[model samples]
Target: MLWLRSIIYYFLTALIALAISAIAGTVWGVAFALCVVSIACLFHIFNLHRLHRWLENPQVDNVPGSFMLWQEVFDQIYAEVRKQKKAKERLAGTLDRFLSAAEALPDGVVILDDNDRIEWCNPASCEHLSLNRKLDMGQPITHLLRYPSLRDYLKQQDFSHPVIIRITRPAEQTLSAQIVPFDSTRKLLLSRDITQLERVQTVHRDFVANVSHELRTPLTVVGGFIETMIDMPSSDAATRETHLQLMYEQTQRMQRLVEDLLTLSKLESGAQVREEEVDIPQLMQLLRTEANGLSQGRHTVEIGRLDRPRLIGNHDELHSALGNLVSNAIRYTPPGGTITIGWEKRDDTACFTCRDTGIGIAPEHIPRLTERFYRVDRGRSRNTGGTGLGLAIVKHILHRHQAQMIITSDLGKGSEFAVKFPQARVIE
Candidate 1:
């Protein structure tokens, strides 16, 4: 373009000079030809100026007149700018919400980069693991977690199986942690407090041991009695009566143990925890009838002002729970000792209180009486044909129904066993 402009400038200058020379010579044809050439050169310069302006030469002028002519192009660029700004804000808001949710979670969460470095963590993870931004940021995951399982898991690269670690951190906290491999080459650590679950397991193990030990003694006694009877001569009638009576009593004791065990098994298995309504008054009446049969008109049962207590539970199962308490009263209370069965409502709940004026449980023994096959006095319990699983079954039944069991006792006065159920839990 420069070369062309230079040639045009030289041609225009030569033509203007030639036109002046022709006009000075007064030659009509030559002068007219020169004048037309000069006019054409001026027009070419004007056309070149317009062509340069149309090419949008940025070096030409900062403010060109095309802003009005190209208004649509300017508007599109403005719209695109606004769209990009809004998109940036939206992305920022989304990220904020994501971080907020992560912080709100109760469990700990840590995100790692491909290099196994701590990249991000929520507040819970921070508190659980004492994460220091200055020390932990861009640091190794091993440095923070400090657990063998995590180290081994990282070493093996076996993401298919998550490494679960039980971590004890600040504030006497016990946590069960699981490292889950998910999207993005990072590991997620989730943890929950399992102290209660651990405690319950320990209690269950102790109960099993105690029950085994308790049942073993009675079994050994029964076996010895049988062996001695076999060793005795068959013709000894006087000895036979005494041995036979002892064996019968042992057999009855064994039967009670087996029955109590079955009752406990049924209650624990929860074959009857489903929503069911029980007429509380009717259930007490039934328990009374069973107690009468056990007493054989020996003990007098004094029932309290029995209000028709309507509760939501299994009638037969509740009957069995109450029956155990009432029968225990009859067996422990002397033939003349009186037993009282009371039904009432406490708070927003219905309670069945069995108060027996029998040999009450001691304070120290009351706590463990609900343990399977646990007896306060083994010899006395055996003499009374007690299985020791009675209170345990009662406790399990109350547990299944989300009810509470309260046992109050004194040395020689009496004992009261009350099963309380919240009203909201009651069924029609």
Candidate 2:
């Protein structure tokens, strides 16, 4: 429409020029027409120059508003420019949000070009792979990782399953890494820290093996004795009685092992701890009697410095914990060795201390004493009728009571196992 209007205006000017020529002299009409055409050309030229400059550094606010038909052209161009600018801003905002989410992830994220060059990575990836964003960008991923297995994993491009790799750059860490094709020219390298998970799995395997190994010996012994009795049924009564006695003892040992395993399991089951007001002095007396019976008068069991403070805890659990300590002292100590059980306040906290003049533990073994089935002398532990889960049970019980166990020992010079209770658990 604007172009049609511009053409019509030019045509009218020509008619006016013709009319002037008919009315006036020919030279005068020609000069007037030339003046009008030049002015019109100059006006269009000025607006065209403004449009060229604005296009060089275009802004919606600075779009040239020209005369007549050119004004319509500028308005359309300005609106289109504004629309494109808004679309660009929206795209930028979406990209920013995606980057922010990737940065906040705990798992590592790395982007790789088709050539396996390092493109971009999150902070977690930097820590996991020991990568410097400014320095390592554009470097080959294989060169930085430097592991044969990982190099093979990338070359294979078989990303159906994640591969576990141990990295030693930053520290000893286990990472589960997988490649995902993100775009036509790039891939996403996702890594997760599975160090703890790997450790847990290893421990689980060990636990199962240990349990089987522990149960195997007794089962074999029981099976052997029964076979022997079955084969020698006509043997003398005394010999038969001895075989039966040995079998009975083996069965008893198996019973003890199964019982201890159950106790340990219960402690670890996250069950609520039983709470009750417990009398410390009375419990100590009961422990003394039990220790004497277990000692069989071979060792001296004495009560020392028994504080009159009552404690707040599970009565039966406390007894079990304290009894295990006393029994351990008795079992490890030789004939005529002294074992002392005491309950007293030290540093404003109630302490249950079992000090013994036994064959003391080595410093290295002390840290692992509470681990299930861990023994300083496996043969001696078996002979002394230990299921090897006593200290482990003690540990769990003390933890439930909000207490800490401190062990101090000198090799061959006896040891002290102490339980310190928090102030909240002690009723003075």
Per-residue alpha-carbon lDDT of model 2 for 1-428, expressed as tens digits?
88899999889988888899999978878988999999998998898899999989998788888757888889899999999999989999999999999999999999999899999999998877678889999999988985677778999979999988887756778989889998898998898999999988987887788778878988898889889889988889998888788888888988998999899889999788769999999999999999999999999999999988899999999999999999999999999999999999887799999999999999889988998888999999989999889999999999999999999998888999999999998998
lDDT of 1 by residue, 1-428 (tens): 44566567667766766666666764654665667678766766655565466446432233223232234433444466567778988999999998999889888888777777888877777766667755688898776766677677777776665455566654454556666777777767665556678768877897688667666776787787678877865637877777778767766767777777777777667574555767777777778888888898988886796766587666666776788889888887877777889888666777778887788888988888887667777788767777778878878777777789898998888888887888876533
Maximum-lDDT candidate: 2
Write down the lDDT that model 1 would get.
Answer: 0.72
Candidate 1: how large is its RMSD? 10.1
How close is every model to the real structure, measured as TM-score? 0.57, 0.82
- Alpha carbon deviation, residue 25, candidate 2 (Å): 16
- Residue 145 CA error for candidate 2 (Å)? 1.9
* C-alpha lDDT score of every prediction, in listed order: 0.72, 0.90
